[model samples]
Target: MVQNPERRTVLADAAIEVLARDGARGLTFRAVDREAGVPAGTASNYFANRNALLTQAAERIHVRLRPDDATIAAMARSRPAPSPEVLERELTAMYHRLAVQQIDYLALLELRLEAIRRPEIRAALTATMRANLEQNVAAHRESGLPGSDVDVVLMYLALSWLIIENLTLPGVLEGYDADRLIAALTDLVAGR
Candidate 1:
């Protein structure tokens, strides 16, 4: 109901923090307000209800996780397509970014679980996720990136779990060298 876009985004970001910190059941307008350090009813003004807030929070997480324009431009500017070795560095760097952004990744994981119980949330997220993956695949094809579409998907799945373990339970991957693992993934992508 609030007309201020900035205020709404602030509330949405606060909602992400609440979702990550307390999970879905604990995400209330009051909780978001508390997290945002706003007045008791401020979140109510921005969000009609919990579902609206949750969807907005999911979108905000996507915005946060997306690579910036500069990064995108650089990827495009590599000229004549980067090599499979470059793909290794690219995927490794991407994994590092995801791992370091602990809160955003954890909040996204929370949303995925919540989606299982709430179809609306699933619907809201599915389109955005599908589009993103499509864009990734399209870009890989257009850029002539060394990996195939299947390779991209494989890296997506593999890196996601790697990041999850790195954030949620670092000990699980403690002894394995990250560089070697990324090299192996790259090898898989190159079909070598």
Candidate 2:
């Protein structure tokens, strides 16, 4: 189980870059090999297949979210209330960053579509989405919001999809600025 962590990180980073730049349609073993500056055989040896490589890349992403396991557990158990204003501000800033830099979202969206055709990808995507929803619900509960606030998580998820959908739709958000959407999401989260 012990291997060069650096090499594995490189492979994962390269795979993410390839997925972002080329979409799922262009993710290939050869492309990842080139991006990572590793031999094609090396990628094949590590990944075994395109799906394996993509799954690993997605796992790498899942490791880096703001509320990790510790945070999620604390939120689930803590009774202390947090100000939604701060969370709203943080969430808005994050969404703004994602929309402006769009690589991660594009990669995620591409993978999501690919998942529709692949069971493994679908499972991974479903798990990730569920985890995020659960995390958001935990945060809301910790912030003194009642457990009946399921709509908070639903709104959060819907607004996220709306941001991506607006970007994906032809000419829909061309005239609109990202800050506006970020503000709207913030307001939604704050129950304004």
Of the candidates shown, which would achieve the greatest TM-score relative to the real structure? Answer: 1
Task: Give all TM-scores, in the order shown.
Answer: 0.93, 0.75
lDDT of each: 0.84, 0.69
Residue pairs that clash (backbone atoms under 3 angstroms), model 2: none
Off by over 4 Å in 1: 78-80
What would the per-residue lDDT of candidate 1 be over residues 68-115, giving only the tens digit for each residue? 999889766774457887788888888888788887888888888878
Model 2 Cα lDDT, one tens digit per residue, 1-192: 326778877887787788889988788878988999987766777776888777777666555434456755754575345555555555565565445545666777777888889888888778887787787777666566432366566557656776687667837767766656655655655666
Off by over 4 Å in 2: 64-84, 145-149, 174-178, 181-191
